[model samples]
Target: MDIKAYIESGIIESYVLGLATPQEADELQRLSQTYPEIAAAVAGGEQWLRETADHYALPAPEELKTQLLARLEHEFQPEKQAPDLRYYRRDLFKYAAAVLLLLLTVSGLLNVYLYNNYRNASRDFVRLQSGIDMMAADNKAFQAKLAVLEQDLRFITAPGTIKVPLAGVSGREDYFATLYWNTQTKNVYLTANHLPAPAPGKQYQLWAIVDGKPVSAGLLNPNCTDLCMVTPVQQAQAFAITLEKTGGNPTPTSDQMVVLGKVKA
Candidate 1:
């Protein structure tokens, strides 16, 4: 079996991204135990996802917590009711029976009013609880993202990782990118530093020059805002990128070349 070809087929990526079918994921798990290369590729892909997620992670606004607290305080606040002073009437002895009846009627009406208020308060409390539950869910999600970001930072900063800068070619001098190559594991990661958005239905492709021939590393996602993992190239003399169609071509177009850089010796 061609291990390299299988690794480059993007099954590992799909598995890492949760896009692989259940059967395919099971097969990948079985294969990874038998092949170290597959296992490494899977691990590398996960690290790339974490790193990318970290790069794009946005912190919560500084005033968000204060605003949420203030809103809640205002929403659940109790309303004050003034005391009834009609009970202390001047003609108390003249209409005792009438006053007693009026008092009974008023008591019944107050009970009904209080009951309705309790019901409404219960409903509002439920709605507020649902919102709290949603916010809790969001908080958990953010915590998970923070954990991934930490892991990504540790992975990228590990020893033996080499950074290769790819400068723009002539007439495209402003474009720039960087390649993170793990020499120990032969894993390659790409980060687009500065490049214009691709035209409609167009994309960028990466190439690794090996022995004077260009090999397809992989295609770059134009909307990629963070680190991107490309196909591992163990014996590349240099790396370059060229504009290509949406899905990319088997060979890079020479005239469309945008960036090129050599691997340091």
Candidate 2:
């Protein structure tokens, strides 16, 4: 059988309503088994009938359908309803477009919010990273200072650590100085800051007074703000400094005295 031509005749639709002659029903079954196209045509006809009934958008009253079916069965008649077909496809399209636009708006907003959050997160991460680096640098400096203090503590506990007191003279009201030294270790630490800076071409020389005779140790120009360091010599009793020639004087010229200290260290 030519399936397309058979469908054009509407026999497939008539067969779904159980109105086909006995011979025609048998022919339909045989054609369905012989060609897949015939089976598809039959299915398509049934679906079309259902969709056509639904297109009206309303069901017949239940009692009306029952009564109609009973009359068709009793009279052995073929009946088809011609009901009103009103379409709202345009309205449905408008509703669908509105829903699609709402979805798009929500999606775009979510994307922008997430982008802003990612940018803020990146900024916060960079700030935390910089703070961590600064903390690491501080920790390194603290560790270095700790090591120097450990060395100082060890030397202070050793046998003879002389604590010498160096007092200020003229030009200093009540400012004082001190020196901690270990002659055996030849290490000295000078602490004095209240003394004013010396005039240009003049400086303060440290003298290790031994048996009323003074020996040159080192010089402080008064410009040194940091604690001055001195080399400890053996048999030193006192400390003094006098303004001498720029390189320093081999002997004290007495009148150029800036400061003198009797070492009771």
Candidate 3:
């Protein structure tokens, strides 16, 4: 149990002021017996209430005191009618003052308790809202990735999209890749199928042969696992991929060529 929080919750004040519900009063009584801090708090509250009552007790007026004495003297001399209430008026006023002070103190403590509860609730709401926002952002990113995959699937399966298989060369026979060319739209896409991962500070670059000379077909992303977009080519007799430095070079290195395939006539 949070002893400090419980002590500051105003339960003890309510219990002392006779305003706590039966269940709350019972719980406080049980806790007070089990916890020394709670017992001390309850005892302190009772002592403070006693002191406040004594502080608010007003001295009876001299004239009222004399009058009460005179009335008491006549009570034994003749037939005393009904008992006069003026005799107990002073005690009644003291009791009322004590009760009023206790009530005001209880109200202040109750306000403090309510404010604490409000602050805690606001903090919980903020944490919950933050979690919801993070989840929404993650879900949005997943949706965007799914949309890209769907678009790639459609592009590969569409009509007029030619699939070209580029086989390994220069003793690297195990290396292979595929190229997709949309002849009608002139769009090109490539997949590094069965190709080994590039080394540090190195990437792959694509080339298209045009009129017996090589033309830049853009660089391949090192992390790409699916269809990666490549620069379009108007006319190409063959397509080739070569290992190059990061960001690639303007010209393909003939000795570093990994895969090549001639376009079908």
Q: How close is candidate 2 to the true structure, as a TM-score?
A: 0.55
Top candidate, metric lDDT: 3
Q: Please identify which of the two predictions, 2 or 3, would achieve the higher TM-score against the true structure.
A: 3
lDDT of 3 by residue, 1-265 (tens): 9999999998888899999999999999899899999999999999988998899999888799788888898566545534445547867989999999999999999999999999999999999999999999999999999999899888888888888899999699999999999887889999998889989988899999998888989989877788899898888889999999999988988999999998886
Please report how far candidate 1 places residue 11 from its true position, in Å.
99
Query: What TM-score, computed on C-alpha atoms, does each candidate reach?
Result: 0.55, 0.55, 0.56
Writing each residue's lDDT as its tens digit, candidate 2 over 1-265 gives 5668887898998898789999999999898889898899899988987897789678658899788878788676335433211236666778999999999999999999999999999999999999999999999999987876776666666667777777766765365566667767877666664555567887767788899999888776455554456666676788766767677888877876666678775
Model 3: worst 10 consecutive residues (lDDT sum): 78-87
Cα-based RMSD of candidate 3: 33.2
Return whichever of 1 and 3 wins on lDDT.
3
lDDT of 1 by residue, 1-265 (tens): 8989989999988998999999999999999999999999999999988998899999999999899998898577445433222444534644887888899999999999999999999999999999999999999999998886776565578786778899999999999999887777778888899978899989989999998899998999766677778888787888999999999999888999999999897
* Candidate 3 collision pairs: none
Instruction: Enumerate clash totals for all models, in the order shown.
Output: 0, 0, 0
